[model samples]
Target: MLTLKGKSVFAGITIGPLALFHRNTISTASHTVENPEVEVIRFQKARDESIEQLKGLYDKAVQKVGEEQAAVFEVHQMMLEDDDYVDSVEEKIRNGKINAEAAVDQTAQELADMFRHMEDAYMQARAADVLDISRRVEQQLCGGAGIDFSKYDHVIIAADDLAPSETLQLDTDRILGFVTSSGSTNSHTAILARTLGIAAVVNTGNQLHNDVDGLMAIIDGLTGMVYIDPDEDTLSQMRIKQQEEKACKARLEQVRHVPTVTRDGRVIKLFANIGNPGNLPQVLANDAEGIGLFRSEFLYLENSDYPTEEQQFEAYKKTLEVLEGKTAVIRTLDIGADKQVDYFDLAPEVNPAMGMRAIRICLTRPDLFKTQLRALCRASAFGKLAIMFPMIISVAEVRKAKKILEEVQIELDEKAIAYDKDMEVGIMVETPASAVMSDELAKEVDFFSIGSNDLTQYTLAIDRQQTALDAFFDSHHPAVLRLIQQTIENGHKAGIWVGICGELGADLTLTETFLRMGVDELSVSPPAVLPLREKIRSLDLNKA
Candidate 1:
């Protein structure tokens, strides 16, 4: 028996035969071409074919996983069409007089390497996207070879790594789970795995091998452990664990309609955080009380260009309408930092986390900010909608954003556009400065949603994206908890409700702590809603 440990991207238990996933490697050998123009045409043809393939994948992904997860393929399509990327490939082909395959291979390497060497971990993950798209184009150039998985059944896939597209393309019914040698929790593959509710363990290094293929294996996603050719005792234990987990899930269904109230009569709102309107089905299925953090940036990130106000309005309207009177707190354009869009034209920054991002960008470019505000305000009439500004550190920034919002409202009023005149406005208490100034900032906004992810990152002066600092990137540090506690206290004192809209909100270990701190609400991923509610119902703040 061989035991390997990895990071859990999802919590589950799966027992199956191991199946090694082998991705075809593109040959990088350079060859002289008689005509550079002909090679350029060949490259363009392959690129176009790759884009078409991505479109098909995007559609497949939308049906399997919601549009929120499917949006990665849309981004991939945009990346393929990026002027710099296309230009680089053409320049290599025309100037170097190399075959289209060699030119493309060389360009992909250079671009992927650039992204890999970037300081930001999110950008570094994007290196995988570059390679994924390049591989698709190269496959098309090489006359395309497809992996036939007809021989595999109920198998746990082992791979060096999986791209978002690759993860989605695999037959989920046949794939009992996946164990990857390399991947971060932030990688798109990990995100897709979580969305699909598949058991997955990543970053196990090179422990997985072809020799293990067809061996009976157990993947304990809850513990991020994989055992290949497990002994009888280990197999028995894993079977029991799987049964227990399945029973726990069945128990969670009982809490679907139950209110997220703690013992001793403390009521809390359990909402779901969503990126796209298409995720509404999961939110409803999971019985989320409301939409806590409707990340409005999806409209920008998934598109090739800036979304029109009407486009934004339609998306907001659909989400709000589907909530059916449940409060949908939509954060305004939190773009920048790890989530960058090429059309934003943001200049390169040494440290983008602290650079012009989120509210700063909205405040600096009111034109862009107003467009989104107009959409939000126009959609307010569809259902309950609350606008939240992200990355606010000072009273001045909040006021500036509100001022722009006011301008948008006035413009809508002059056009006789209908909207919720009393739409609530809030700011994300992400930075320590915002947390410290929560009392005053809370007065300016109608509510406060503590963005614990950034709050902890900024408070500890640790880059959460830096995997090397994972040990030191303490999300549970006393300072971060104190900041959250302080923010909650200050918001309550100012007569404004406070909630947490970060990954920490989903952590069951802290549910009781948050309840004791008088947190009014928590917004987590849709899959976490029922489990969070169960945790809340099991906690008694009085005992704490």
Candidate 2:
């Protein structure tokens, strides 16, 4: 028996025989072509073929995943047809007089290398894209057929790494799970697998050999552990685990459209916490009542610089449009600390978590804050939109934020821009001070959202992002619970509703606790909504 540890991208248990993934490598020699124009034409023909291939891939991917995920193939198509990419290869063939294959490989390497050497991790990850498109063209030039994996079934995939295209093209019904030797939880393959609700273990450091293609294996995606040829006892335990997982999933589906009312008849609203509109499909698929938290900073993070008001407006508008009358509570410009935008050129802070961030940055830079506020307000008329401010510590800060929002409203009114004049506004009660003073602060806002992640961090005085702090960080600490209880009570006292929007909201163990405490809403990740609803339906909060 052999065991390997990796990182988990999704949580599930699967037992299956291994089916290895293999890519065909093409090698070419630099031949001096007689006519440079003929070499260019050859490249063009191959490029056209690759473009058609990607178009087919895009269509199929859209059917399997949603448009957001299928966009990966669309991006691959654009890369193939990029004039700069084509011109670069043509320049090599026309001037250097190299054959089409050699020129294509050389040109792809140059562009891929540039991205690989970037300081930003997000840009560096894009290097794989350049190489992926190049591989398609190179395969055509070498007269090789592309990847095909339709023959495999009832197996766990053993891959060096799966590109998004490969993951989308495979028959997922037959594929039980994935074991990749090179990938992170942040990789596109991992993201797609999680979105598709598949079990995946990544970065296992190559345990399976090519000859061991049919080895019996058990994968525990929750623990990031894989067992090959395991002992009888291990197999028995894994079988039980798999059965329990199946049972749990079946129960969750039963409550897919059911209201989150406890056995005691207490009602709890379940919402989704999404960073952007890309997660809306899951939000709808899981039957969430509304969007509890939309971290709008994502628009800025993905851009090289600050996003324009129109750009932010379109993103916010589209997200609300999909809600179809369900509320979308958007938090404005919560950028700082771990999630920083490069264009901001922010200097390293000794204690960034406790320093200028979220509402502080928005308050200091009214221009940046107002730009996002105007976008959010302008988009309000299109659908149900609620604006929330983060990192609140005082009633004065809440008043000040409202003042800026009023200024944006005035500017929009002067331009005759339509918006929800009576839109709901809220504040995140993440700090101890905010919780203690929530009675006063709640009077200034429409509602309160307790950001449990940050509330835990501040109350426990632990840097939640630090690996070493994992041992000390406790989300369920008495202090954190007391603050949450106090904030909810205060919001109610001030005649407003309160919700919990953080990792703790998804915690099944806390479902009864929050329900008994009268938490009006629980907003967690999309995948947790159905399960939470199941828990809610099973609980007797009155007895608790």
| Candidate maximizing TM-score | 1
TM-score for each of the candidates = 0.89, 0.86
Q: List the RMSD of every prediction in angstroms.
A: 3.0, 3.7
- Residue-wise C-alpha lDDT for candidate 2, range 308-353, written one tens digit per residue: 9999999999998899999999988888866766688777788878
Q: Name the 10 consecutive residues with the lowest summed lDDT in model 1.
A: 115-124
Report the lDDT tens digits of candidate 1 across residue range 368-433.
999999999999999999999999989998888888999998999999999999999998999999
* Model 2 TM-score, all chains together: 0.86
Backbone clash pairs for candidate 2 read none
How far out, in Å, is residue 246 in model 2?
Answer: 2.1
